[model samples]
Target chain A: MNVLLDNLSLFREGFIGTLELTGASALVAMVLGVIIAGFRVSPVPPLRIFGALWVTLLRNTPLTLLFLVAFFVVPKVLFPDLDSFLLAVCACGFYTSAFVAEAVRSGINTVPLGQAEAARSIGMTFTQTMSLVVLPQATRTVVPPLSSIFIALTKNTAIAGAFNNVDLFNVSKTLSNDGYDIAVIFLWITLAYLIVTYAINGLFRLLEHRLEVAR
Target chain B: MAEVSVTKDAAPAADELVALKNVNKHFGALHVLQDIDLTIAAGEVVVVIGPSGSGKSTLCRAINRLETVESGTITIDGKPLPQEGKELARLRADVGMVFQSFNLFAHKTVLENVMLGQVKVRKVEKAAAAQKARALLDRVGVGTQADKYPAQLSGGQQQRVAIARALAMDPKVMLFDEPTSALDPEMINEVLEVMQQLARDGMTMIVVTHEMGFARSAANRVVFMADGRIVEQATPDEFFNNPRSDRAKDFLSKILHH
Candidate 1:
């Protein structure tokens, strides 16, 4: 308790960092995920192949390896000035995007073919059909799955703690090294993750209820 | 599958609004449409009737180029329908389609469903589009349900809303693909009534339906198809009263007797 009280600021900053990482990665994942999902469903053959390869490669690779590649090789070749923290965010985001794309693609499948056909019959282009008609309906069914993916993403950010990203897990490890009881520190960090994940769950629950289809 | 011309009914002399020449479509091994030659004059209501698997729906779908034809030319308002891209989309805007399932956007309210094509495709301003959508809903007799989502409405109400959505585009031709077949028996007449009103309003329409009553009452001509071939074409009175081909007589006997 004394150690925890002494490290209150550490906890707060660490938690804030975690939140920032989660938020940034989530935003990146969302945009990339939607684009990849579009490619999966696109009429063009090459795009479908690219989408499939993206999902398979990213989803199969370990997150630790992605983090290492992003931190080491990617910075050297692509972004020499990129911070390790930004690299961590990109690594986690790109990995999570594969899951997000799959969830969104499955959500799109849940919408009947008639909906798209109806939109097309009314003269809407393929993009308009997807954006205005299909995506809205797809969103209603995807909240739960998307929440699950984001929750996983939030937890996965702890893996970045190894590279001194200063998230909750890293803070706990550093404090434990400074003579604080490791079990208690771990317990508190666990609670911190629970709080963030629960917040994500609640946010998605609210969205699900708010955006549910009329049925 | 042989083409049979049972009626010598002279083609209407008005401007040809939709013309199909030697249209052929195949689904893998199944020859779904075989050399379909049809012409629709302005303000004409042509009802296509046949048993299941007879390609009547395919014939109607072909008009809007919804189903790609293997070999054919389809022209609307003196312009050929392109297979894809912006030209096809433009052609589609001039043709409205109402499906049997209503197919109203479930996520959208009835009013939004009616307004979307106008706003997005036609680029109509929102305020004007909304107003026109409301007027169309009212015309279809579902104005009061404009704010409700499609799932909240009954089948008849939903179909009416779909018609309103199609009409909001001010399409030159409206295609109805078994619009009333999916409705409940009691709800069928309400939708038929709306369609009857559209016919009276001189909307160029191609209807694929099982409703012989609608055919006899509203259609200028009835086309009978069997096994991917048009077996007969005649005025409704002549077609129903004295079907010429044996296939038409057999189809009529099965449907009308049942």
Candidate 2:
């Protein structure tokens, strides 16, 4: 208990860092995911093929491998002295975006073809139909899956600790190594992760309920 | 008296409203519409009836370019349809389509659904578009459902809202592709009742449906299709009573008995 109290400040900083990284990465992943998913569904054959290849390549590769490549190898070879945090964020975001793209693509597919045809029959342009009719329905269908992706992303931020980023996991490891009781330090870190994940999951459930009622 | 005078003045030129000349459509190896020729006068209601895969729905969809034609020409209000450009948009805006499934935007209220095309396509003022949308909703007997989403309504109510949405655009021609086929038997009458009222009001329409009763009561001409071809066409009285083609007679017998 004394060890936990002494390491409280380090834990707080670690928690804040995880929050910032997760929030920024989730936002980036969502935007890129939507764009990639749109490309996957595009009528142009080459664009669709390129999007599919991107998803395949990203999804199959290990996240740790991607982080290493982005942080250590790519920067050393290309842009030396680039900020490691930025590299970590970009790597995490792009790695998760492939999963997000698949989730969104599945959601878009679930929207009936009739809805798009109906929009066209009513004289709406293709872009208008997608923006006003199809995308709203697609987004609603994807919310539950997207929420799961976000939770996974939050947990994945701990991977940044592997790069010596001093995230929650790293801070806890450092505290445990520095004469703090290992069990208690790890317990605090586990509790912090559980709280963040549980909060996000609760918000997703609330959103699902609200969407059902609105429907 | 004023309504009678307006009807009389608007009555004569109805025949020249929509015309199709040698319009043909193919879906890869499948020929959907072959040398199809049709003309709908203003205020004339034509019903295209046929079995599944007979291309009756395709025929109606072709008029709005929902399915592009492979050959021949289609003219609306004397304007030849341009294949790709702003002209297609203008042509589409002048024509409205209603589907069998009542494809209302699930995300929007009935009023917003009706007002969307007006505001986005026609650039109508918001308040004025709302007024027009309300009037259309009232016309279709769904005024109370204006604030509700599509899922909240019954199949009949949704179809009525769809009709109102199309009517709000005030298109010169309305094409219905099996508009009530997806409704339950009990719900069929409500939607058909709205369509009957539209026919009475002299709305130019081409309906693709198996609802022979609607054809008997509301349509000016009944066209029968088979195997991607119009096998026969005549006044409903003649088509139902004295179908000349063997296929039409067989189809009529099968449907009427069931």
Using Cα atoms, each model's DockQ against the true complex is 0.62, 0.43
Residue B119, model 1: lDDT of 96
Cα error, candidate 2, residue B31 (Å): 3.8
**Model 2's CAPRI class?**
acceptable
Q: Which regions of candidate 1 deviate over 4 angstroms?
A: A212-215, B6-14
lDDT of 1 by residue, B31-97 (tens): 9899889888889899999999999999888888778898989999989888666778878988999
Best by lDDT: 1
- RMSD (Cα, Å) for all candidates, in order, is 2.2, 5.6
Residue B193 in candidate 2, Cα distance off native in Å: 3.8
Candidate 2, which segments miss by more than 4 Å at Cα?
A: A72-82, A176-184, B1-30, B39-43, B68-91, B200-202, B256-258
| Candidate 1 residue pairs that clash | none
Judge candidate 1 at residue A163 and give its lDDT.
82
TM-score for chain A of every candidate model?
Answer: 0.96, 0.93
Candidate 1 share of real interface contacts: 0.67
Clashing pairs in 2: B14-B41, B14-B42, B15-B41
lDDT by residue for model 2 (B1-258), tens: 000001223246555788877878888888889887777788988889989999999888888887878888888998887764456777888898899888898889999999999998889999999999999999889899899889999999999999988888888999999999899999999999999999998899999998889999998888788888878878888888888888888988998986
